[model samples]
Target chain A: MNWAFFGGLLSGTIMYGVPLLYTTLGEVIGQRAGMVNLGLEGILLIGASVGFAVSIETGNPWLGVGAAALAGALFNLVYAFLVATRRANQLASGLTVMFFGMGISAMVGRAYVGGGIAGLARYQVPGVAALPWVTRTMFNYDLLVYLAVPVAVLVWWVLYRTRWGLSLRAVGENPSAAFAAGRRISALKYQAALACGFLAGIAGAHLSVALARTWTEGMTGGRGFVAVALVIFSKWHPLRAIVGALLFGGAVTLQLQLQAMGAGVSPFLLNMIPYLLTLGVLLVWSGARRFAAPGALGRVYSGEE
Target chain B: MSAFTSPARRLRGACAAGVRVVRKGWAIAAARYAIVLAIALLAYAVVLLLAGKNPLQAYSDTFSFTLGSWYGFSEVVVRMIPLLLTAIAVALPSKLGLINVGGEGQLYMGAWLATWGAITFTGLPAAVFIPLLIVLGFVGGGVWAAVAGFFRARGLVNETITTLLMNYVSPLIVGFFVYGTWRSREVGASAFPQSAAFPEAARLPRFFDTRIHLGLVLALILLLLFWFVLEKTAWGLKMRAIGGNPEAARRLGVRLGLYIIVAMFVAGGIAGLAGMAEVSALHGRLRAGFSPGYGFTGFLISWLAGGSPLGILTMSFVLAVVFSAGSLLQITQGVPFAAVNVLMALILFVVLMKPRLLGRLS
Candidate 1:
């Protein structure tokens, strides 16, 4: 392949991968803290619709980004209350919240569809952007793409290197033990869920304000679902989430590039590539003996005796 | 074995079993469902208010439009054709502690294979070819579902994730045919993205002067049959035992993997029936958006019903009524279909109210 074609594929990966990274890392945290937000797809929709609308109205992508995260957090507040305090089933509750979020987003987003408001403006870092080879190959994306890397690293650090991370792990592994250890297991779960929701919101903001630049009903498609599966495939590790997201991003970009170069297969058939690859990865990874997960992954925790 | 025992001893055993039946279970269940239903309705009312419509008026209109009229009631029964079949697809797998969320994908494969039968065996008599289409639908969906089952049974993959992912994939394969090779080639209809309309003989016959098709009869019969199997049969007890505790069942010599595969195959086939109904009866031709989210809706139905066949039937009718009126909500109140989705979501959320029986994942 020509260098220009290769560059286009890499750029596509970055565009798609960054948002996935945000969602996957968020899921890693949520699952790590003994909760699984099946409603993530809904959360992303809310974030995308709200983020896109606010940015359009205010003329500030940052404002849109903040609004998206807030929307996600507020939505999760209800879910966390139900699952954490009300002892609802995590899986069912997440699914409900997901539908609720999608409905709310669609109800308001109908007006904003097809309105072409500009996305986040791209600006170059002075020294880093000017490097002879680096400038041409990297550091050339929107600020969000660049930020995703460090944010992931920071998440990794918190999940592995801090006491809070340890407490979260304890809760995920054995909530009863964490409770006996004097950790506020339910409160920690809510915090983890809320923070994860905030990240999912930013991920949606990336899709609307920086990538697709438009809002649509269920625009997140199955990517939110993909991210949830990615967390499991990566074994709930933060850094591994980045790798997994990029690998998926690369698969998607590769197919489009193949189509552009006149691949003979029908585009609809070609669209199955990423999903097939995901299945393949999941099948292979699940075969591993070292496949570890949070002990109490989907169980409802009981704080009282 | 027990039925062959002496009559007097059997009477004593029957009395003991009757005593074992939890009478309080019904009252507790009713109370739990009441609270959850109320909360879900409250949530729907909140959405109605936000849309600037009077919640009470919209509720009355919805009831009158869907349940109050003969036409609306018949329409609800018609919608329940697919819902009924798909709900069984879900409940069967769930009884084995597996979430067969691939109902959507299996449904798609059913439509595809049934379409092939309709198109290929064009010269066959209506009676022969119609049954052939039904068989093809079952085989197509059964095989598709068995793929996830094989993975979960042999590959240790989580059925929930795999089935959900496959659900996203199956619709695309159908779209490929509808949008490309199978695009209607009739003189004036080649412009539309669909198959050539089936011959009259290929169509499923409707009951006298109504939209309802024979699939409704078949679904009702199957529901009664499956309920008997699930409640009174020896094999059904084994399936439930396995679902309750896989490790214990394994210790007791239950063939875990084999039963799981069988359960998944049956689940997928039942779901396939839903797709067959949609294609063979309602749509009359395979097309895009023919059965969007039908599988997911069925999944929610089974979960709401808590795996009871009768509960599934009742819940299916309730949801069918809600969906039958979804369009009226759109036409009259300027609400979106997402509003119905909102309602379903809220209803599903209340399943958590009584977690032990309904929301028990495994």
Candidate 2:
């Protein structure tokens, strides 16, 4: 209601929403390329664990972020091998990848639990920093938060503008047709997988190295799933995903704020807000957005094989 | 009429025929399962070695604890009860090309409603109370899953996402009640977030002085019924038709929406029975987070078994052994319990790859 409350809510939204935004952006790429990585939760965990461990060992958060990104890309190759190469069912493959992620992350992160890092530094925009209310809410954040929107824009540009993007879209729209037109369907899918992994890993790193600033087992929770739902919410568009992620982020921030304020609602019930909102969003938009999905999305492409 | 055989001879002939059928296929199926297990274990052993633990010792410890003792073996059977029920929950819907991933949520709702019945009907006789709890559990889970089925039926949203998302919500709803009005009011128990203990009559009867309960019988009955309906009944034939080709089935006047809703409801109801059994027989009370991912494990079991009745039985037993071994490995290998997931995922990966080794026989 008041300025401080409103400002805090807005600031919290940026802090929490940024990670979801990055994940949504990553999944947007993968889904657009006709692959759906349900095992994204695992990807995020790998990034979070590897990022935190490297940061702790090297005492350089940037190195940790880099390591996390590479680890994620590498991990995704396993999923790509199963889904893209072996022609396994995508949903089952994704779930297996998720189980693998959960096991590996727990094993890898056991020693680093509760360990902290001098995480990404926050910066304030010079002019906006002077404003009374806006300064507190919008001007200051870690580098990832600042880059989140621009990256979404960049993703949109690449996905919509480039010739490579055109080939990729063609492949997703109709792999057989794309193959006839000389696009390498499997190769394009792999490229999309790599890009998706890199972004998802960065998203994980943001959780450990920037937001949480500490490592723990299962730290990413189900945010990966929320991002999956958000992709449908955004109608598979990068620009639209920015709004979807922020709305989810706002829902999360609102719940935490309400719980912290000692509102009469049980904290357990309050925790349901984001997930319920995801279901609600899907229910409302999925009927309309069914037409917006890539034609060959979630299907295993056999043309190249 | 002159060639008519005696009843005893006919019975013997039928038994021989059944044996011949099993002989024809089970060898290849058994070999495939054995190879899958070997590969999974080899991969998990490598992980153990990398983690600086002795792989041999971990395997030995797991087997010694789970397979070498009667009590441990019984525990596996106990674990398999819920896994079987939930697996059937998944396997049934899957027969119609529906992915019922909300087993966990359905299980919780079943337990929640069963608890209500147990607490309220405190003085009822065991004969009456047990069936009451069973019905309540079934209704709870059925309604929970039907919501998702309804959405899918109306073509509003995919059941996969709705069911998956709803899985996260159902537990919180249970938590809300368990932490608030349902909290055990007993002075010493207030610290724990669990409901009051069920009356003696509310609990499922156990067997052989072990934890194994009547849910095993219920699960076996349901599994047999599942096989019969799918293979013998016209309803099952309609469902298979729908799964094989929905368009053709629709043209034949099979109500796709009705089948979807009813199949989901029954599948969810089965999963609910698992929850009810766990609360009444295993824990004797409703506790927050009572299940350690039994519903999810059931999904994996159903998938690993390819949704066949006998396959469900075999896979549930195998995974139950793994579940039992998980705790032993934690202490002996100095690794977290989650390390079991690696083995599980590996098994699934091998199966999902659909290896050509058994291509001819399968």
Best by lDDT: 2
Point out where model 1 deviates above 4 Å.
Answer: A125-139, A289-291, A303-305, B1-35, B354-362
Single out the weakest 10-residue window by summed lDDT for candidate 1 chain A.
A130-139
lDDT of 1 by residue, B212-266 (tens): 9978987888788788888899888989999899999999999999999988888
Candidate of highest DockQ? 2
Write down the lDDT of every candidate, Cα atoms only.
Answer: 0.83, 0.88
Q: What is the TM-score of chain B in candidate 1?
A: 0.88
Q: Write the per-residue lDDT of candidate 2 for residues A181-206, one digit (tens) a residue.
A: 98888888888888888999999999
- Model 2, position A302: C-alpha lDDT score: 73
- Per-model interface RMSD values are 1.9, 1.8
lDDT of 2 by residue, B130-214 (tens): 9999999999899999999999999988888788888888888889988988889999888888899999999999999999999
Q: How many angstroms is residue B147 displaced in model 1 relative to the true structure, after the best TM-score fit?
A: 0.7
Query: What local lDDT score does residue A263 receive in model 1, on the 0 to 100 scale?
Result: 83
lDDT at position B57, candidate 2: 88
Model 2: which docking level applies? medium
